[model samples]
Target: MTWEVRFSGFGGQGIVRCALITGKALSMYDNKFATMTQSFGPEARGGACASQLVISESRVLYPYVTLPGVLVALSQDSYNTYEPKLRDGGVLIYEEDLVQPKEDTGRVQMYAAPVTRMAEEIGNRIFANLVTLGCFAAITKIVSAEAMKNALPGLVPDRFLAVNEKAFDRGYEYGLELLETRPLSIEEAP
Candidate 1:
């Protein structure tokens, strides 16, 4: 079965890095097949950016996402652009401070976390993506925590690993807490 996920935000927010880390974690450490595709505008910082990931137990023939089963939106623009593309009963994870989702369609499950503010508390806003990744992992349960941790060393700088690790832990814990309150998880794959 294939699971399509999209991570989206303005550029410089590490939208691409979120997909990269998730793809690496799932493919390299978790023994899953994952393919990623990305798109961005010309501006480096404010441009809209999106990364699509396909994860499966077997080989994935198509690399692009037509309708995402899970959508992680870190900005309002991303939410506006990708919300309509989400399949019915899809999961939506968003930054609480940045996104105000549409009226409840009664068809999708949603979770919001203050990842950027949490990252700022940890150190910098740059780690927001990792924080969001942690939320994604804990909420989705598609990729294991060990796999995600194992995939981080080579991805982040040696000096910043500790901070990033902290950011991940914080976000993960937040996700777990959210799950306890919301009690929502991805529906079993058909």
Candidate 2:
């Protein structure tokens, strides 16, 4: 089985880091094969950034995603750019506070999390990406909690590892709450 995941947001949001961590979780910890590719806009910070990961139980034959099975849109521009390319029955995870998503014409199952807000509550907004990663793990159940946690220590700065873990946990908790309620639309998301 293969899962194509695309993580998109503006620069400085750790878009590429999210994919790298997830790929590590899937490949090194979860016994899966993951290949990642990244894209950055012309400008450095505050510009469009995207990272795609192809995951499978076996070797990955393709490095790029044809139609992402999971689209994590953290910015409005990313949502607008990639939402239409999501495959039927795809999973859409977005920042509830940032992205105002359009109606999905296909069989896409959309989920929203207030990752940035949650990260701010944790402390700073920089941890928002980790929070989003937590939500991704909870909603998708593709990466194990143990795997996600294990992938953290080395990837993030030593001083901020604790905060990153906290952000991940917060997001994970919120995601579980969302799952329990199963909010139907972006309007229904909390």
Candidate 3:
């Protein structure tokens, strides 16, 4: 199976890091084939940035995502820029507070989590990406949470690992709650 995923947001949101961590977890820990690419604006922060991941059971021939099957959008600008490019029947995971989604097209499945707000509750907003990653894992079942945690070392500083792990757990649990309550399996978009 192959999955095309995109993680996008303004800079300083760890958009690129999200893809990196997921790719590494799948490829290195979960024994899948994953290729990743990144694009970002010139500025260090508050500029558009994105990372694309192509995950498969076999080798990946291409590096970019043409039509994403899974989109993780953390900002309104990113949701606006990438939502239209999502494939039919695709899955969209977004931050509810940060994005006001357009009317549903009835072709894609959408789920939202307040990752940034949750991160703030944990002490820093920097962990929002990790939280989102956890939500993505739980909702998509693309990779295991154990694999994600195994891939975190060296990527996340030792001092912040505990908080990051907590953030991930919070998001993962929230995603599970969403699935139980909202049912992402529904064919029609909500």
TM-score of each: 0.96, 0.93, 0.95
Q: Give the range of the ten consecutive residues with the poorest summed lDDT in model 2.
A: 181-190
Candidate 2's residue-wise lDDT over 101-162, tens digit each? 87756478888898999999999999999999999988888789889989997899999999
Higher-scoring candidate on TM-score, 2 or 3 = 3
Task: Compose the digit string of candidate 3's lDDT tens values, residues 44-103.
Answer: 999999999999989999877888889999999999999999988888999989999988
Better of 1 and 2 by lDDT: 1
Model 2 TM-score, 2 decimals: 0.93
Tens digits of per-residue lDDT for model 1, 1-190: 7899999999999999999999999999999999999999788799999999999999998888887899999999999999899888888999999999888867788999999999999989999999999999999988998899888988999899889888888999999999998887557543
> Candidate 2 at 40: error in angstroms?
0.7
Superposition error at 106 for model 2 (Å) = 6.8
**Candidate 3 ranges beyond 4 A from true positions:** 186-190
Flag clash pairs in model 2.
none
Question: How do these models rank on lDDT, best leading?
Answer: 1, 3, 2
1 or 3, which is superior by TM-score?
Answer: 1
